[model samples]
Target: MLFAIVSITMLSCGTSRNLDIERGTGYNFQAGHPEYRTTVFGYMDEEEGTLLEIGAKIVKGSLIYKDEDDTLQARISVEYQVQDLDNNNNVIISEQSTEIIKSTDQDISSTRETLDLNYTHPIDPGRYEVVVNVTDLNTNKNITQSIETAIPETQKGEYSLSNVLLDGKIVGEGGWEPISTYDVKSKVDSLRFVFQVISPQTDKRMEINTRLLRYASDTSYTRPMHYSNYSPSSIEYKGLDYDEETELQSNRRVLTDYASTFIEFKFANQERGNYRFEVRAQRDGDEEELFKARDFGVKSKNYPAVRSARELARPLVYLMGEDDHEELMKISNNDSLKKEVDRFWLKNVGNANEARHVIEMYYERVEEANKQFSNFKEGWKTDLGMIYVLFGRPWYTRSHLKELVWFYSYNHSDPEYSYYFNQPKLKNKFFPFYHYLLRRNNYYYTVQYMQRQLWLTGQILTRQI
Candidate 1:
């Protein structure tokens, strides 16, 4: 019998401190395909509290376009809400808007064309929960996401820095256009960072320092353990180390006090890797300093699609034995690595056609994992990524106060098909904000091994029967 993959409902619990974030689901072979993408940015405005910016990008292919008056049209509805975290999650601000996109050419609907949206709101400085809801009017499909953010207070005569904004445009092209995905595509030659510096004194020199750090390696999942709920007392964060440090601007004098000044920095020729961009501000004769950082990744030209031999070999760790994975990693030559990969699949599956099918399905999951769970490190290397690539998407997902649970079977009472991942609260700067550690236990060993054997023996040919 072939393995059957089914649709599952993801349950999220709402709370002030621990806001539940949800991703859209689909009936396709891949899992958690959010219909649209939304990005939120908060910047401090000297006169008008905080400037909240929201950008939502929707692919035309994902929506249902209708024929109206011989023109293809797609309608989208977006709602924004801001809740005060300090006030029992009370809704303080809300807005709703609808957009209708009309296209005369029907071919645009089949292509990967996108509808870009931009919204800006001024809010007070405080801790709040921001929620964005997007709906495709044609299909009535909706996706919602909530995030908890804190806006720092900047008073008069106080030196402070606004939130850093990232844009893909090179210098002197046009105005500031924020890159919503944060994932810098290979086509972008240079990255532009913009921020405002609120100065207290006029004609005073302020030093701005910028540092870039690349993700090194993660050894957290080197050994698989039995499933359990025992939380670690102290979790040592791994991956993301200091790669390069540089001062972008030094001793720059501001001409005005009690006003906001824009500071711009541009960097070119970034390598393909996960990175953390940090900025620090300090004024002469001031003992206090301000700092901010953001996480972004420089993806390969054909990202989410694993084409390189090295990239293809890395995800094989989930299926290969420890010694075998180590041996494959030792092969530095690209040509030899590709040959070994082809040999490994054929040796286990016993045929080229079946092996090809298995390889295609396996890498497809890897690509989807990268799209869903990537932050600082590639998604396939993350704990959740590893489980996704191994067992496929869970049958059901439920979120708790601080933990996320995934069930492989419809029967929630069965512990045998359940997996638990804990989100530990860490004070370290190196760790990403949304990192989750898998609660490894011996229970997973047998099931995961059985699944891996199914792939190797060519027992599982497709995602579903």
Candidate 2:
């Protein structure tokens, strides 16, 4: 059972439009369109309502460097707006700032070096939407994304927990830095979570319990096409198989109203999967408990690269016939599976060199899909991930009120090359709000088949602006 039935609604296609990078509304935020990564954290502040922190990490290679007085430099602009969700999405706070990155080495942009930018703000307790916009000043290209956060109202005597923060110490790093992407890199052996426990009574003994659970399955498709005819239903929230648990007792002495503590969980040799980390706190004499949870993914050491035979075979649902894909997936032996996958590609392209090229290009799209569209399940398993892996990046992307549209051709008036996805009204705690459902139609069947034929014949399809 590699494929599961997905029910999705068929909506009328929308008008084709190009992304407006300057305005920041039409870009695909979840698809890594901004060429940067961002992470947000919220903390409880006694005086200020909530301390909101945004961390943006930009890879030097993604920036356009200009030579200035024998030195290479790049400039970036970051702007953010906080909107009150309860008040008709009114913008309550907005600010913009810029940073200049300089390098003496000319080849700096070719390396994996990165610049870290941090922003902090205080806001009242409420449900709010935070939109962060980042632009490469030299290129004038930008990306904008929005995330929903809730700040709990604090009471004097009630016990509460602040938002959990995930951090990791890289192999060479001296101190722990925030793992803002929530995807733990292969270089990290253990995960560190930091948060504050607020209690009313001084010198109170408390018990803290932590549990880690791993998802039971990965997002693999059994079907050929990504769209469905029925109304979309949420992905079933599979039970998280219990993996590990730990308990710590707080020493009965408190210097202030709240105590900050961090717990480390080792993930060395752990299977690759999505995991949930939960914490529960209760005072020794009281039954009331404070709890918090966060979800994250563990990437293979050679991340974004499909190394295993099973990983290589799964994405073939897009390229192989249903019967062929099913047979490939049925191979139980890893060695045999690897050989068969090699033979399939070699057979399709008719030569060893072309086979190698096609395999690399195909999986590269699969890897990019994983990085861009992953949610509760892997990105390639999602609707957007499927389209991305098959068709490559859309020539134009636009985000409407609750819908996301992508166009493959430069002709904005033609609906034939446009695809539409709508965000469902249903909500899931384990899923991000940005998840969208593809609008299926009979017309897509013809297009999907044509794309599959193009790939099988060793032809790469891409949109030229």
Candidate 3:
């Protein structure tokens, strides 16, 4: 199981605040061969007034493929139900499910793929609960996750802004790839934000000031800073002061014979953490008034506390390389350790929070190994402990009378290999503990691949199962 999302779009409302806010519950489940893991991420949004939008992003390569009409097919279904929270007695606003099936003309090699889904329904502005169900049709296994979201009452008689949307890849006109979860990982295509501005008048130009701020918990990143993710040929947003040549990152056009417009901005290569986007609108030559402000998060709950710079170095032992590990182990003071740890992850991972995410998750696996396999020494110091710490939870595990087998996905193109371990001495104090016998060819490649894959989504990525 894994999490996937990478896009940002803006939305706003006029007199009333349009918070397309939805909390992600990090829910996931699977069915079928345990080795074949599939995970789903999704969320709900209120697009134009009363227009509800639900989106999901799925990442998996272990789908069951079967021959169908001379072609191998993999099919999955997604079901969603939106109910009025105020009245739960079967007062359903919308309910339906869609099947997403991918097939190949030949035997599937690796089903590794990324797919997106969007569902829309009309409902009045109010509170609602959305339940999403994902099922692997081939295996008949499924999981459900639910969230609460609302569409505020529309405001009139004042300049209004639409809801802010966090979107992924843009496909076509009015097509936005919904960012199913705020828990973002990896450098993706681009973060796109879309906003709509409406005023009572017509053909009137407005100056929209936009600011982006990065935050760590309650602390702000030393005021707002501007960065561009656009190509050199694209127009950039500097400060205020506009000429015809100056184009703010906005969609300025006439709509419904009134002054209605949508502002959009795209950013690239941002690290994980909380972010705030501030948009202010003003009539030409008038004082700028704050139109809409909201805070968005690009982080996972997995490493919530490590965002602080002071407590940084504590997890270094679990993630550092051999030479770096030796040097870090020699640090005698907490102050110096924090400095070294901060420097290491910042330089290597390019973001302090990203570095903490990597360290926390790796050490999390290490601690799990300790609790599950402790013996003469700490579990992390034992062979079985080492494998668990580095390779993470095995996709498949089988235990026999005196032996255990762990299978891990190495090359997606080929079947995964197995790690065989057995208890050599039944009388030993650690009675049932098994030891890895280097009897098979060296598993260095498998270990390397496993660790790298973990880091791929761990360093700047989201939670995985």
Candidate 4:
């Protein structure tokens, strides 16, 4: 089912985009980059002309940018879209955010131009559309073009994984931001978490921590050829009384009471390439053991650098307090609550009228919390829920602290932050004990103002909260 080639075509042309573009009914332009003399397609561009089992590939390669910004007096903007015309109802997936940019040498900021043009689509041999509409300073109107092509199917009973590269990262720091998985099969216990030291809250030169947890899982397992592999011995199965409605759990027993063996690894203090994570799996019996690896990188170069521990602890917002869950229920009923919620989503969309990231983030968070929260409670309605929804799940959490003290740490690489919290363990401890702290440099924000009351932000002492 995975053997599908994606056809591409220019979608629109307008004053919104500036450029000179051409896309014929069928791809006729010379393929590949002349300067590099590389092959037209990254892979062998095989477009089988079959409808039921046909795949087509297109390699537009790099955008040929002849910067005339100096004197040509030509300002251009371009927007593109490609569609599959074969099966009207079949879902056609195409890359939409690819772009090319040109700027003066001195304008070499992080906002400089980027070119991402490799596209793939599944379709039949027919008149597909490749639309690229461009606008220029000379005229206000934009031009649209289309291309048609046919694809020959691959040989019977065959497929390819030569160019397949599976890459992603942890939840915090927002790697693969809009991506989430409820399929237990897709879940990997230990992933190589990667991100830059851009957050003022993270230690730029800090070391990474690694932990291998003990679990009750079945020994037999199944995983993807490239994504992850199964270790029959390492997997402990959970009881059926628990609910795990994931697609991958169909034929296997579930796992519960999972915990990790705490371990930390140190990396050099130099900045260079993106971080790489590799997980080694041991096989039971005579199965061949193998290694799995993934890549993780951050998109926001100007990401807020992690704050110093002193800077993070400078101000204590609440000296002593209690988490009033009752306050949360009451505030949830606020008349203007919907307005605040709407604004939250609007900010993420960056476009209120056409915003979807808010909805996207909601589902993504819900799925992640459910999959992760079942360890002790339902994720959707716990303190973890309250926190994860706002900040995010910590990269590392430990139960070694007292029954009342639950430690949630993010980016263990940084040795500075000791982000642990003391919660309601003994229900009758005190009336107004410290719950949590949200610390800033000599300034603090109170979650108390939030509709739902959760915990105190930063409390390092028993004398306080």
**What digit string (tens of lDDT, one per residue) describes model 2 on residues 169-269?**
76676777666564555657656655556555445666777666665534345233444543333232221222332322222222333444433444443
Scored by TM-score, the top model is 1
Model 2 residue 214 CA deviation in Å: 3.0
On TM-score, who's better, 1 or 2? Answer: 1
lDDT digits (tens) for residues 288-342 of candidate 3? 4535543444431122223333324433443554566667757877678777765
Worst-scoring 10-residue span by lDDT in model 4: 33-42
lDDT of each: 0.64, 0.62, 0.47, 0.27
- Show model 4 residue runs off by greater than 4 Å: 1-248, 252-321, 329-465
Better of 2 and 4 by lDDT: 2
Cα deviation in Å at residue 236, candidate 4?
21
Candidates in order, TM-scores: namely 0.64, 0.62, 0.46, 0.19
lDDT of 1 by residue, 1-465 (tens): 111010001122223211211111211212322255666556654366557666667766566678999999888888988898889989988989998888888776544456887787776666767777877788777777665565556555666665556667644656555665546656566777666676644456777776655555333343454545433432324344434333333333343344466766777737766565666777778887666555566765445557788778878888888898999989999999999999999999998999999998889888778777765556776778877887887888998876889888878887667777776654232343456777776777787888889888888785321
True-structure lDDT of candidate 3: 0.47
Model 2: which residue pairs collide?
Answer: 3-222, 7-232, 8-230, 8-232
Error at 62, model 4, angstroms: 24
Q: Rank order by TM-score, top first? A: 1, 2, 3, 4
For model 4 the local lDDT of residue 78 reads 48
Winner by lDDT between candidate 3 and candidate 2: 2
